[model samples]
Target: MGERAYNFGAGPAMMPDAVIERVAREWQDFRGEGYSAMELGHRSEHFADILARAKADLRALLDVPESHHILFLHGGATPHFAMVPLNLAQPGESADYIHTGYWSDKAMAEASALVNVRIAASAADSEFDRVPDRAGWQLDPAAAYVHICSNETIGGVEYDGDPDTGNVPLVADMSSNILSRPIDVARYGLIYAGAQKNIGPAGLAIVIVRDDLLERVRAGVPSVMKYARHVEWDSMYNTPAAFAIWVAGLVFEHVRKAGGVTEMARISVEKAQKIYAAIDASSLYINRIQPASRSRMNVPFFLREPRLEQRFLDGARRRGLLNLKGHRATGGMRASLYNAMPLAGAQALADYMTEFERKNG
Candidate 1:
């Protein structure tokens, strides 16, 4: 276990070691039950207890209000791109979107196919290195909702705080950064995230939607896609991702035992600061995003000599730092500082970067 390399991939990223160990121990039989969690019937009392506990732990960790319903749904955040407009926005009604980076653009493209999409603000002009100011957002007062990708994994941009949308409900795709910090759940009408980065695994998505917004589902929308149906059925309208939910449940408990989101946020900031300081001091590496908009979760940096990228990756891997390569579309490297990544891991990467620059610069 100690020999494992530090993982920094964008999604399906690192999880708490405690959570992994617990899963491994219970993989064959959960809590001495006759069957594995995956094999247990979803309707069985045992599995129902698991589901209830997971939801409760998550709610406590996030301090979710009773007014919001937490649904452990099947599809990842991508599917919600269509489901959002399908359930919330009418065919002709527009939904305002703030396009920050790759994921946000994909979200808008998917929503556009279902309903009218208004680009309220975009940072494409800056190659997605920054988030546009809230003051410049051109929101439609009549739009059903205002959507934003709270954190951009590929572009390394993040909103420092929630954007004010007045009466329009705020819907955020918080896939990469959810649970990494303390967020005000009340400020968002809906917050959806794939349980890969900071949650648990890849097959599940956690959706926190305000109860009142569930009444807006468009006619003819599939029962499975409707948030109301999920809430009514307790996220079990169909067979849920039992194994993933079990693991996420363990993670939620782990977070709570480890001092919750406030502690997670403190460590996340420290990790990002350590790595970003190294990048700032080195002439060989450069982070393109402006300081204000830079993401504390994903730090995308570039090598001064593009040809040295492979060498850098190789060196980092040999040094037990893994997945430091950036997204292919943008090139260079990215270090995703998720909640499960310890401060020691970030410091190790920072140290490696400094030594690499000294040897290669």
Candidate 2:
């Protein structure tokens, strides 16, 4: 096996070396069962224990309260965009949506088809360069719930504080940046994240929902769309994504042993700061997002001389830094420094940036 480069892909991104190595060894046999974790039956006792431990570890890491239920769902956070409105919003009833960036807007579009969606706040006017001030929000008194993308993976904006929605409960799609920091579960009615980013792999989404919100689903929605159904069945209403769930469980255990969310938050800040500081110090690079709202998980920056972009990217790859490529839609460069990206990797990128500028600037 080759040395893993400093991977900065946005999703299905880097995972801890230890987790990868351990999983590599266990892929041959798990817990003396003489079969890989992937081959194990989801309904078997071995997998069941693994599933339970994953849930417990995630709960402990997030400090999820007993009043909330966590589910390992099959679809990515994309499906939850529709499911959230289906379960939470009755037909003709409105829901408040904060439009911050691409994902948030996509979610609002899905919800708008099902229910009246009020634009409580939007960063559209600023070209999505900054998160809208909380004081600028115009929440609807009669809305089913207020929704926000706690972090925008594309635009790289993030919320600095808990959103205040008054009587209306908050629903958040924390897909890209979930578990990169500590979150107070009590602050939101529902928080869902696709497993591809900070969690495990694709095909599994972790939904943390308050029990009360689960009970408030109006009838006539699809049974599968109901959060209550999953809660009642322990997220196994039908056959689950067994492999993804098992891997997600291992990731949960890994995060817990590494000292939970608080430590993760600290490491995340340190890692982000290293890159952001480098960007800030360099005349050759610039991060457009407002400093206060800049994402600690994804750092998007641009070269002062746009013409040298290819040279920069090609050189990065040649230097053993992979996937530092920016999203085509929003071109330049985006280094997604998720939890699994170590401090050394960030420093390596910083060093690369400095040397690249010294030569190219």
Candidate 3:
């Protein structure tokens, strides 16, 4: 029971203190039942209630419409890269993709193996410093759907708002930024997020899909890969991730009590601004992404002296900040300011940055 570090890892990120405390309190016997949530069978009545409440709370927080289905599926966003193309596009039909950064590029690469994938827009020319402007997108009129990684966890680029995709369905891989802001659920045809970032833990992903898209799933696709199967079975086609779902349910409830997505968005902006401002004001650090497209959830910055990268991380750890190292592909520091990272944590990180710079600058 030592004090927890201010975690800054990209996924399996921080959870609210309140949620963690609650989970600890109920670990042995959930709601007076004689078994832990992890021990309960997925099909048990108690587990069913947990699943229902989790979905209901999430729907309320996101304002998901009745026309849409909320599914808690196993596997993270990587699976969806393949599943999306298999379910949505026909043999000859292509899907459009906006390649903003690493994750988006990965998505396109995976989908290209299964179906026709058209690069409607890409920010590779700029080293993914910003999202390509909507006006610059060369979208196909006959594309089955348009896919975008709303936020790039590695490159730290994010779309400020929803892209206008015209009649085609807009699908977003919102893994890092989902529930960090208020989004109009109806605007996107499909949105999926791995639970590790803003939701709960690893091993579960939440998929929100519009009803009409279920009808378009390729007939030969495996039942497990079909959105319709998950929807029909209430996301429990087989044994679900019971413990992860229960924890996620607790998180959803916590979010509601904390004033929902609007409040989360407000705090997210505040946290990101604090860190970005510290980086901008310093001669010792740099955030390469354009201001407009900077991610509120993941802030990747580089030290002026790359040699000090390890020292910076070591110092951060000793100061009670942890997981501040950047991704291997992008060698620098990345502070993921997810919803669970309080304003105080961001401020602490800023203070550490300032002090560290003064000593080493």
Candidate 4:
């Protein structure tokens, strides 16, 4: 049998081998139901149980408070960029945004069309190498919410702790680091993430909106984009993503049995530290983000000699290390150490980085 290669893609990244194996066993005849999970009716009692269990397990995993409703929506995190303002703010009202990197920029661009998007703080002058200090942020007291990308997948900068927004709602797009560690759910008004990273496959987005925030949906917003409508229907206002939800349920179960997010964080810290230590020791590579702000999930580093980039990637692929390329906007290398990435995988990559430097640099 061929071995599975370590995957380091930023999104739709990787899944636990146990989860993948369980899917194989259920693919043709799911739990003796005589049909594939993909073909099950979303409204059927069978699927209802699946949906309910998924929600229960996720809530247990994250310690999601009863005040926040979790909704499984269709589009990825991009849709929430617009939905956040549409549901939370009135026409012409301001919403504060913390500009950290590429994903943060995209969120503001879409939100600008819906409300008076305000750049409360930005790290643009540093080329997004670090998140702006929260104390320097010029927040709007009248703003609907304060937005921040908890983890900048492209630049590899992540907030170590949630910023205090005082009375204003603190909204975060946690697409890249949602389940990697434990979080204080009561601290935020809303949190949304695309399922492709730590949750499941490509077809779902998870929205955790505080119940009171649902009552703030602006007039004339479509039911599809309205948070309250989905909350009323329990994420089944329309058909839910049945297959993805099923898989996510298994993932939630797997993570819970694996000691939940607390254990995941310990392992994540070790994995990222291995790679970052290798980069720091080598003169041939560099990661520009400030050390304190560096991400434990995505490690984006660069080879000192740009000419050797292609050769480095080619050599890594030969060793069963895959998807090491960085985002196209910024050319270099990125290694996403999601929850599924084993510590051995990170150690392997770190070892390769050292050997590659010895040979080429």
State residue 170's C-alpha deviation in candidate 1, in Å.
0.4
lDDT (10s digit) by residue, model 1, range 248-347: 8989999999999999989988999999999999999999899999899999999999999999999999988999888988888999999999999999
Q: Which candidate is the best by lDDT?
A: 4
Instruction: Report the lDDT tens digits of candidate 2 across residue range 27-116.
Output: 888777899867878789977887899889888988899988889998889899999988887788999999998999999998889989
Task: Tell me the TM-score of model 1.
Answer: 0.98
lDDT of each: 0.91, 0.88, 0.93, 0.93
lDDT of 4 by residue, 1-361 (tens): 2889899899898899999999989899988899997887897888889889989988998999999988899988999999999999999999999999999999999999999999999999998888899889999999999999999999999999879998899999999999999988888999999999899998699999899998899999999999999999998888888899989989999999999999999999999999999999999999999998999999999999999999999999999999999999998999999999989899999999999999988
- How do all models score by TM-score? 0.98, 0.97, 0.98, 0.98
lDDT of 3 by residue, 206-257 (tens): 9999999988888689999999999999988988999999999989999999
- lDDT, candidate 4, equals 0.93
Model 4, residue 248: C-alpha shift (Å)? 0.8
Clashes within 3 Å, all models in order? 1, 0, 0, 0
Model 2's lDDT to the true fold? Answer: 0.88
Candidate 3 whole-model C-alpha lDDT, 0 to 1: 0.93
lDDT, candidate 3, residue 94? Answer: 94
Worst 10 residues of 1 by lDDT: 34-43
| Stretches of model 1 off by over 4 angstroms after superposition | none
Q: How big is the positional error of residue 261 in model 3, measured in Å on the Cα after superposition? A: 0.5
